[model samples]
Each structure stands twice: as C-alpha cells, then as structure tokens.
Target: MGFRQRTMENLVITPAFWQDRRVLVTGHTGFKGGWLALWLQTMGARVIGLALPPATQPNLFELTGLAGQMVSILADIRDRDALAAALASHRPEVVFHLAAQALVLPSYSRPAETYATNVMGTVNLLDAIRQTGCVRSVVIVSSDKCYQPRATACTESDPLGATDPYSSSKACTELVAAAYRSSFFASGDHRGHATALATARAGNAIGGGDWSTGRLVPDAVRAFADRRPLLVRHPEAVRPWQHVLEPLAGYLILGERLYQQGARFAEAWNFGPGGETAHSVADLLTKMAGMWGGGATWRRDDETHPHEAQSLRLDATKAARALPWHPRWPLATALQMTVDWYRAHLDGQDMVAVSRQQIARYCECEPKAVAP
Candidate 1:
C-alpha cells in the first residue's frame, strides 16, 4: 500500500502527536506563518519562531498574541551567520521555512531584495542545516507560481518557470532546495546527516489579520472598515484560493510524515485546493464584499498594474494519494470563516481568542481543550 492508504485512521492532527514536540518556524511574523505558529502552540508543541518583527503594524503575530506562545528570534534570513546560530541554538527537530519577499508589485520595484530574500535566503538555511545536524524534517514553503504556465491544473512534477521576479525567485528557491536534498541531505545511511527535505506549494492563502497592502482579502477588509468602495485590479485573473489553515494543515501532516517515514515523503508537494475551487479575482472580491455586508461595494480599477499570472490552478492528486491529505473546507466555507474572523475583530473581540477558536473548530477531532 502507498503511504496514504497505509494510515487512514489518525488523519487528524492530534494533540497526542504534538505534545512536547519541538518545532522551528521561520517567517512566523507573516500571515500564514503566524497562524501555523499559534496552531502548533495550541497543540502543546514547543515552538520557536525565527524572523524579523511583524512586517505591518496590525500583523497576525501581534493580534494573535503569539509572542507569549513561542520564542521569537528577530533576524534576517539572508544573514547566514545569524540564521545558522538561531538553528544551532534552537535545535528544533522539525523546521518550517516560510520567509520570503512575497509581494508581486513590491518585487517589481525591488527585484534585487526579492531575489536576495527568496533565493539566497534558502541557500543560507540549507547550509545551516548542514552544520546543525539536529533537524529531521524540513518543509520549505514555496509558491504555486513556481510551476510553469499551464492551461490545466499544475502538478508536483510540472516544470518550474517564472515570468516575473517574484515568481522566478521562488523558482530559484525550489532549485536550491532540490540541490541541497540531493547533495547534502541525501537519503543514505549517514545517521545524523540524513535530513528529509520537501517543498510545499500552495495557492493564495486568505484569512483574517492580514494587514498587507496589495492583497485582495486585506484590501476588501480595509474598504469595509473605511466604508468605501473596494477597487478591483486584474479582476479577471483566476486563482485557486484556500483558507490559510488548509495548507498549514498539509504542512503539519507532511512534516510529521517526513519525520516518521523519511525520504519517501521528501519531495515537492502541492497543497492547493482542487482546480474546481479556483475563481476570478472579481468573483472573489464580490463574495468578500457580500460577506462584509454593510454598504459593501467594489469597482474595477482601470489603472495598469504589474504583470501577474492571468490564471493558475493546481492538481493536489499526489498529496491526496500519498500524504493522507485533502482540503477540508469548500470555497464558500473558507470565505465565511475568513469573513467571520475579520468581523469579530471589528466588533472588538479578542483576536487571539478568535484565532484559537477557528483552529479548534477546524480540527474537530478534539473538543476545545484547555490550551497550554
């Protein structure tokens, strides 16, 4: 039997699996990383985060009160010495690297910084692993844009390419990771050196506490909060959208499986929602406006923007067949959960509590237990 067929019972991420487990999350200050860090903490894991401070003022890291939950190391991923020192000092068993210059428009202006952060930063981390010898499972989070242009859904084995600086940088990250896996962390009998490395590619991750400019969900939230009509750019651009937790869950499962089973699980994996889940930018914004409710409206912006892919989707068949993974929430449900989170924040609800509540609700395997 394949890996997915071998274990079907304990598909859920159980607290029993995470109790006292040591995890290191790079980019913990970013939107998806913050959510993953908080979720890991709730599962009773010993979590440590390595990244610069939150990029925006109202970042998820601060709003979710994640500082009290994990050890936060403020450092740049491009700094090889600092990154190596953090890894050596923390000595976590599993490492999740999500640090990168992740904005497309910004990359158009700051291409050098984007390449430095996304490409060479990956190189620095893998090199550190060569010296640290304590990590067993490493999940290097890349983007769906790493894949070559495709009319149908892109798969794990698809050719890697890039039409822009941001996408090309991610594509470079993938190549660097593959080279490291083959050269240093090769699956051999070398006991301490055999680290299993895999890359995770996911489409647009949307949820609350995303204060970044130039993102669809955050822009919609800001328009709602400011009581203005949202401006839609690239309205016809299609993307596969999933909740932040969807891919985060996939990462957690992939990490656990890599730690347990080794090289078989060490490869590129796509954690995107199925192709059917993809919708146009206008459709997504319209849905977001509906969820926000009061006087919510949007108009297409005629101003020309930076070059972004016109359409993209993913085929998560390999992940589904190999890792016992599948997206749990449908598009509407994901959108609803996202809208509910921002709404609660606007209503003066404690956002930390709200984030945890959503995590618990998603992992229905366990009732809301007393968080550690």
Candidate 2:
C-alpha cells in the first residue's frame, strides 16, 4: 500500500501491513516485549526475539509459550558483537529495541548495571543497525520518567532530565536515538538507507503477566495471592496508568508510519493515557482489592525507600493529532481485564487463550471519553 493510502486508512495497525513482514523485537522475554511479539505473531509477522531468559518465574513470555512461536534468541544486549550478529542474521525490516534493566529500585542499587544495560546497550543496538543496513523502521521504548520532574503533564518537546539512574539512563537512551537519527539515518543521507528511527515515552503500564518486583500491580498480585498484606510505597504518588496494550498500539502505529513516510513521522511520541485516567497508587490498590474479593488487604509501608517522583504525567496530544491514536480502555476496564487474567491464571486455566482473547477484544474496542 502507498503512503497516501495508509494515511487515508488512519494508520491503524492492519494485518495487511504486517503480514509476512520480517520483524525483530529485543527484550521479547520481558513483559511489554512479550505482548508486542505476540501481537505481531498473530498478525502473521515473522518475529525474531533477542534477549536474556525470562527474568522471573511465571513470567508472561514463558507462560504464554511465545518462545515456541517465534525465533527466540537468548543473548544479552550488552554484548555488541552478539547484537550485530543477530541483526545480520535476522535482517529484519522493522526493529523494536526494548532490552534494558527496567526498574527504579534496582537502578538505585545497581546503578552501573543499569547504565550499562540501558545506555550502552542502546548504543550497541543502534551501532549494530548501522552495520546491518536492512532495517526500515526502529522504535526505541523509553520511559515517561525520562522527563524532568514537573507539576504538569510532559510533552515530547519537554526538557529531558531524571534524578534516578533508571530514568536518567532512559533520558540518555533518547539522546542516543536522536544522535543516530541525525548522524547516520538522516533523510538527506547519501548512504541509501531509509531507516526511520523514533523514541516512545509511555506512562505507567499495569497489566497481567508483569511478575517483576518493585512494580505496584505485580507486587499486589503476589501479596494478595499469598494472603499477605500488600505493602504500599508512596501511596499518594499519582501516575497516568493505562493497559500495556495502550502504548503498544501507539508503538505499532508509529512504526508503520515511520516505515511508510520516513522522516515525516520520525520523532519522539508520548503515548500516555487521558488526563482522567491519572490516579494515585492508593486509589489503584483500592479498586484492585475490591476486585480481588477474598480478604485482600494492604497497608502503608514505612520503610525509607529511595526517592521516586510523586507525580508523572504525559501529554499525548501530538499522537492524538498526528498518528491519530487514542487510548481505548479506561482505567476501570484495564483493571478489570488485569484482575480477570490473574484470576484465570490462579485457577490454572490456559493463559495463552486468555491472553489472546484480551488482545482480540482490545482490537475491537473503540475509544470512549473517560470521566474524571
């Protein structure tokens, strides 16, 4: 299909664009990557996954049996040669770079590893892309924490700064992508490569199968399942929380636009939830506890934890106007879906079917105006 035709179709994720496409997703063993890989696979794309083994037991990647469905490569993104070799072998036309040490508390303890994995690992991947010249569209997944702390919602043009190692590394990651886009992949480059690269900054993603420690939803699930009181850290902290599929949908749309129109869509984007979806951690836990009926309880943690932002929001107006993407599932629906998935998992049901059903349902959903 032509660029005009795609734009007329509103650049929504269509199977026609992804069918039989050669795609590579780094960090496919992780939570967001696992979902993206699965969605692409369902659209008939040939997906190549590169990352270390699953970080936690009962992770989404392994539980959904994603490894068997795609080309799963167990390798560290920190290894430059390994990344280059994998890119050369896969020769993918689309690349999604998601491999990183993706947590805040862990970054406080292991700052060096966080920088090495998030900062240098990105350097390795972009440099490897420079060597293997087949890639067309590249979307680097960054965090909303990459923005400088502020009282209002952040836009793509906001000043990028962070005090925490994880957030700082992501800020540097965005710089790395911008440098590569300007130096090597410039639209006027004479190298004959048309790789359109961009960065995606999203808000807090709460969904099923994120078994990572230090995150709110997963920690709640583990605590509630064990019949223990969940510990709440920074309960008053407010975030623009949305389902994992919200930002993933934005990434897919951005990738497609980058491939078809190149420089026109090659820029940073914010795929955050609507303003009404912003809620405090305590509020989220209350709703979750209500959904998890049998004696689910939580209490405030008094531990002196490391500093985290009390408020983080993103202005996704650029995405809403440009890519024409809007969040489909409201916070209530997102929470219900998340709780349903875990409840099914706890019952030992086939999670693969459950996960796919959610994806199908999400695809059919229309955007609704969320009430504040």
Per TM-score, the best of the predicted structures is: 2
Candidate 1 lDDT by residue in tens digits, 141-248: 999999888888998888999889999999999999999999989675424447999999998999888889999999888988899988888889999898898899
In order, candidate lDDTs are 0.85, 0.89
Runs with alpha carbons beyond 4 Å of true place in candidate 2: 1-11, 188-193, 369-372
Which digits, one per residue and each the tens of the lDDT, describe model 2 over residues 1-372? Answer: 643233235437766788889999999999999999988888789999999999999899988989789999999999999999999998999999989999999999999999999999999999999889999999999999999998888888899999999999999999999999999886643235688999999899988899999999999999999999999989999999999999998999998888888888888999888555689999999999999988998999998989999999888888888887888988889999999999999999999999988887787788654322
Candidate 1, residue 316: Cα displacement in angstroms equals 0.3
Winning candidate number (lDDT): 2
- With a 3 Å backbone cut-off (N, CA, C), the pairs that clash in candidate 2 are none
RMSD of each: 5.4, 3.3
